[model samples]
Target chain A: MNSTAQDEITAYVFAVRAALGDLPEAQRDELLEDLTEHLTEVMADGEGPLTDRVGSPEAYAAELRGTAPFVGGFPDPPTRPNPLIELRDQVLPVLRTADVKVGGVLGYERASDFGRLLRPAWWVLRGYLAAMVVAEILDGGDQPIGLLPRIGGSDGVALILLAAGILGSIWLGRRSFRLSTWPKAVLYGTSFVLVIVALTGFTQADGYTRDSYYSNVTSYDNPYSQVEDVFVYDAQGRLVTGARLLDQNGQPIHLGNAYCYDDEGTYADAPEGVYPYCASKAPFRMPDASDAPLPSPAPSGISPSAAEPSDAPATPSPSVSPSPSK
Target chain B: MDTTQLLKGVLDLAVLAALRDEDGYGYDILRRLRTAGLGDVGDASVYGTLRRLYNGGLLTTYVVPSDEGPHRKYYSLNPAGRAELQRSGKVWQGFASTMDDLLRERGTA
Candidate 1:
């Protein structure tokens, strides 16, 4: 065979080998040798030059390969599984649905667990500090005296509690309780400073006078007013009627016939003819003749006809009087 | 009784019968089947049957190498394969004869 034809034949044999890579090496080699012999015989049978009868190398190789046995000792056909058949026959749709649900639920659980384990303490402290700084920036320098009272007030105490909580949570979360002590201490210190700063802003905003500040921090009503007569205001400066004022322990106090006035000037008065808003079951309080006689009405410069009866409830008076005139 | 099952059972018989006299590879088997007027047999089916027969030890395999091109693997029937062919041929003859008798009686009616 010509050199060119031989090269083409070699290339064809290599292609067959590549295609049959899965076959055992010995079987593949035997097949290649047999094909070479057959080609030689075909060339010898031709009358003209080997090249003339063989034609182009590509054409001859094509003919040879086309004649190769594929199954009953023929060229091996490419085998592949049908995907549709596999999906229909082998995979269970219900199982896949179950898998997806389980996977989704597991993912949510993991996320929640991570948040619980690593987020709360750090987030609370950071949020608290950031809020304080924002307040200071908003307050600017308008009122410094107002800031002092807040720093010294219950806000100061709340900051300390929050700092302690954060340190405790961190210590509990650590593998070695001693490892994070310094960082925890630093966090507490920083939290203290932030709380003080925030309280200062609170004071500057005159928050001390606000019922929320007094109720939440001072555990008392405005010092200027009786606790039972204190009223809470809404964001719009309206008296939130029926919103009972709570003590530090979150209990309600009722004083008979008393009227509570909020910042908005809206007032809630006890029922008519009632003295103070006391929690007494009595229908109405009338003068108790059984008690010691009360002092007589003043006569000098006061007209007896003009003097009006007092509306104060006959119930035992509170040890403390109503707030002095503000 | 489905066409697919019917075709699969007959395919092996047809290919073996065609190659009984001549030693031919894939294309040769296809061409000879077509020439013998069995062109309905698909080329792919014949090739697959050839592999099945070889793997079953019924067909002996050899490669004829070419100087001008790639080698070809040739298939021929062994003794056991010939015996099987003869047995299947007898069964087919009996079935055909039965069918012919049934048709003849129907035609008479």
Candidate 2:
């Protein structure tokens, strides 16, 4: 027979087999034992298309069933009651009803149609989740999972695996319909586990993001969280060392710690209530003794510029806090 | 009258009777039945009936290699099948005569 005729016979046989799907596999196969040879004969005898000659394949299978439907050659063995079959009998009708009802709500003819349309999308996602699962297994749970799968801290390995996984998944998903009993069962079980993994990964990611956002809000709420020390300065911006800070009601207010970076760069305690406790950590440079002579005899305790009138602005330090009044 | 509905009742009998004189392949048997004036007999029905008879131990099959295309599977009736044919043929004749008599009495023959 020609290739077209051959194709026609194959398609006809497939349809007939599908129509007979309700029958046991062995019976169906037995019934179609000579289907291809018979179809080829029919094609050779006729001139038009196979369907035009023999009616539709489905009708053909039905007519075949009408004459002498299959009788199993062997007496049915005493079979143990299968719980899965019972579960299927219970669930299929409910699922079919839900398919229709859900389809109506979603404005489709059937929910299964919507699901069919989303199958390719699911294939892609299934691939990503599979990659994640593989990554976890390879790492032996020693590494924390991120949104993307990384194997041995290499993005390249992860990328290659991800690509392979997605492609392989799509291939399997497309062909999964053709799988036999046990392989299909394995496929379904794997998909179920992958779905759980995807959900868990998403939940962890959400929590991590929420916690970081909360920390940002809490730290911004209080502006003085890291205010360690305060230095007073005049309108002239001169370093006002040893100046006392008083509150609104004549009460001395303490702000900075008494310990500071000393002259030798060591942390040491200074006397309490002394504003500019460390001279080596002054915020501004002062005039030399030759440039500005002190009128009063207090050069050792305070700089000559500190005794001078407030005439200039002081410099700013990123680490040191300016007086709140300033 | 649609002979297909009528053929449905006796296709098993027809298929068995076709293989009574000579063993034939599915397509050949179908052609024989068509030539015998059961023109509406479906190919699938004949094939399925042959399988059922074979499964029921009334028919036996063997494959013949052919150069034209695929190998042909030819079916032949066993002694049990021949006996069944005789029995069903008599029952059909009796039923037909009774129906004919009733029709004649009703003036619709």
Candidate 3:
């Protein structure tokens, strides 16, 4: 064949090869070789243009595939790639990008046309949910909530839950369209619940910590007590102890005499002698009237009773009372 | 109604028959069929049928290297293929005769 005829045949062969895209590589190569041999022989006879005589390359490929035998023989020529499968192969990966996956949710194979149409809404919701997660993380404070607690706070649990929500939302968003009926439903349901809980956590987390701090301060019958005596409660409502009162630097602060008067003249938790006097002149007097008609311990002459000497400087130590006020 | 549809059913038989007299390459067989008035036969269909027959062990193939553009693969009938050809040929004849008689009777009626 002349070079012109050869180029024509090469181009035709290329098209045929492309059309046979779904065929196994070995089978396709063999088929192309056979067709090339046949085409060379046909063209040597000086036939007209191949396209004019052979029809389109795709139609030719279909006929070739229809009669082509498998390795063992022709056991019903391997089924062609269905149009829907072709569409899926083309569309799914493009839609699965992290940027586009939110919109791709409804575009997944099993998703209905109506669902595909709703992809814009899913896209918007995805943006909002992502923002909600970011907002939650930012507001969650510097200490991230991990699966385990470091600071003896519920912040970790809340943060972990929020993280789960973020992960679940992202996963569910990308694959929602591809998931089968019941599984998609379950995943969506789980995501919905997670997002709600996470959003609620993000909104209320600061208030939660503040309320818990106040409750903990009040949880102790006397906040001025020694570190070991400060009471706390577990989720089980059982009393827990050994908690220390730490300053901002986490160093334990001394609650001397464990009594001080507040700015409101209320009996406050303060160190002894720092408050200039006990919440009353008689220190170590228990607050409950029913427990005992207690005799004042100041005159009891307990040698280590430092509260007895400190009563004289009641007005001089105003600067020192500030430490116990906390 | 459609000869193309009928051709699909009988193309295997035609291919086996085409190889009976002497060995022929792919395009040679296509020319023989075209000369025998199968003008509508597709090049790919014939090539694919040759391959199917070769894979079925009904035909054997050998390459003939040429100074031309490409090597040619020639197909010949094996013993098993000859036997199949004879058997299927008999079946086709019987089916054709019966259909002819039925058509004649309907025409007369």
DockQ leader: 3
RMSD of each: 23.3, 20.3, 18.4
How many clashing pairs per prediction, in order?
34, 5, 4
TM-score for chain A of every candidate model? 0.17, 0.46, 0.25
Candidate 3 residue pairs that clash = A256-A271, A256-A272, A259-A270, A260-A270
Q: What tens-digit string does per-residue lDDT give for candidate 3 at A9-57?
A: 8899999999999988988887777777688787787669988777788
Candidate 2: C-alpha lDDT: 0.77
Ranking by DockQ: 3, 2, 1
- DockQ (C-alpha based) per candidate is 0.03, 0.27, 0.28
lDDT per residue for candidate 1 within A1-326, as digits (tens), equals 56665565466556656765665786556445444444444443445544464455444434334334433322224668889878876666766566666657767434445445555565555555554454444444454423222232346744654465456545544533464778768766766776776676557566546755546533455453343442222222222234343345655445434654545666666653233343332222225434523324422421222233543222122333333223
Best by TM-score: 2
Model 2 stretches astray by more than 4 angstroms: A68-326
Deviation (Å) of A159 in candidate 2: 99
lDDT of 2 by residue, B2-107 (tens): 8887777777788888998999999999899999998877888887888788888989889999887788888988898888888878777887899999999999
Give the top-scoring candidate (lDDT): 2
- What is the C-alpha lDDT profile of model 3 across B1-109, one tens digit per residue? 7777778777888888888998999989998988988888898899888877777788998888888557788899999989878877877788789989998989952
Question: Which stretches in model 3 have alpha-carbon errors above 4 Å?
Answer: A69-326, B67-69
Docking class of 2: acceptable
